[model samples]
Target: MELGVNIWSFIDRILCWRQPCACCGAPGRALLCPGCLADLPRLDNPCRRCAEPLPAGATPLCPRCLGPRPPAFARVHALFAYAPPVDRLITGLKYHGRWEAARLLGSLLGEALAGADPLPDILVPVPLHPRRLRRRGYNQALELARHAAARAGLPLEAGRCRRVRHGPPQAGQDAAARRRAVRDAFAVDGRVDGLHVGLVDDVVTTAATVNELARVLRRAGAREVSVWCAARAGRTSGT
Candidate 1:
């Protein structure tokens, strides 16, 4: 089994080598070439809680998500600031079924989480409604979460939670409407009590979905819920 796995890995590497970079069409071992990778919009001095870009020397939590009442998740870990090439990669994998983009993005997310002191007990891909799951054939979040779990040496507990409600695509909804659509959309099944759970998703725009999911996990006695997404979209329409 080990030898067969190694052979397949070698073959996969060869195949990846032949394909051009998804961003700039550069020939390379990685999905995105170094030049395009460098050009990707990385979050700079972001608010620790929401991963939104903050003014220099601003507080850890953004004003919009901060208040007397604490937020659902502890913090968000995002690689990019949702723009240009990063957006293309997300859209490609999510809408166009580009598995290579998912793998590359997940690997980067794993690398970022590698140094976490107290790693999450399990990684949970945000669930998709049964209708959407059937239509899409596969959940992009699950694909990315599987790759990230392997890289981070963690277990993926995708079955622990489920989406019970189906709503319209969040892309066209404002923040308030998004919240309403996602309310009570998720339910935890298996043991999650007191466990540190990490919610994995591709992009976090208004964060309504993750917030609602986190609320469910917390009610089920989860110790902490941290969101991990490939990109964090800016608050404004165009940033």
Candidate 2:
């Protein structure tokens, strides 16, 4: 049995090696080449609650998300603002069949989790409803969480929570409308008692979705919930 397991593991690694890196097109580079990895647009100064770009020395939460405190925790950390090259990368992942982008994004998320002042006990990817999952043929958050879990050395509970409803995309909705659309959309599948859960998502805009998911997790006995996202979209016409 041990020898068979070792052989399988070796075969898996070989298969992985044949895939091209998602960024920079380097061979045997996991998902991103070193050059592309170095070029990721990292946010140096961002709003605390939403990760929006802020002027140097500015307050954490932007004026918008602060008028009323968010339903989730008081802080959110995003790796980059949703713009330009980063935006293009995300679009490629979502629409252009670039699944390897998830690996690159996950590595960045793992770094962010490592540098966090407070770390979570477990990582949970925001789940897609069954219908949506079938329609899209993949869940980007799950792909990211798998890579991030390995890099962070944290347990990932992919089945601990689930999306119970099929709701419209939160984009193009006002804050209030977003809240209504996502409210009670998530359900906890197992015990999270006393655990600090980190919720992972591909992007954050109004944050209504994360807020609702956090509420359900907390109600299910999670001690605390923190949200992490790859990008934070600025308030645009749809937002």
Give the number of the best model, judged by lDDT. Answer: 1
| Candidate 2 residue-wise lDDT, 72-177, digit = tens | 6546768777765677777777656565577678877888888776889999998999998888888888887877887788899998888998899766777788
Compose the digit string of candidate 1's lDDT tens values, residues 1-239.
99997997897687688678877787788888888888898888888788878888888788877877556998888989888788888888888899889889998878777767678889999999999999988899998998899889889998888999989888767878888999998889966889999999998877788889999999999999999999988666431
- Lowest summed lDDT across 10 adjacent residues in model 2 is found at 21-30
lDDT of each: 0.86, 0.78
Q: Relative to the unseen true structure, what is the C-alpha lDDT of residue 72 in candidate 1, on a scale of 0 to 100?
A: 94
Q: Give the per-residue Cα lDDT of candidate 1 at 57.
A: 89
Q: By how many angstroms RMSD does model 1 differ from the true structure?
A: 1.8
RMSD of 2: 3.2
Give each model a TM-score: 0.93, 0.82
Off-target runs (Cα >4 Å) in candidate 1 are none
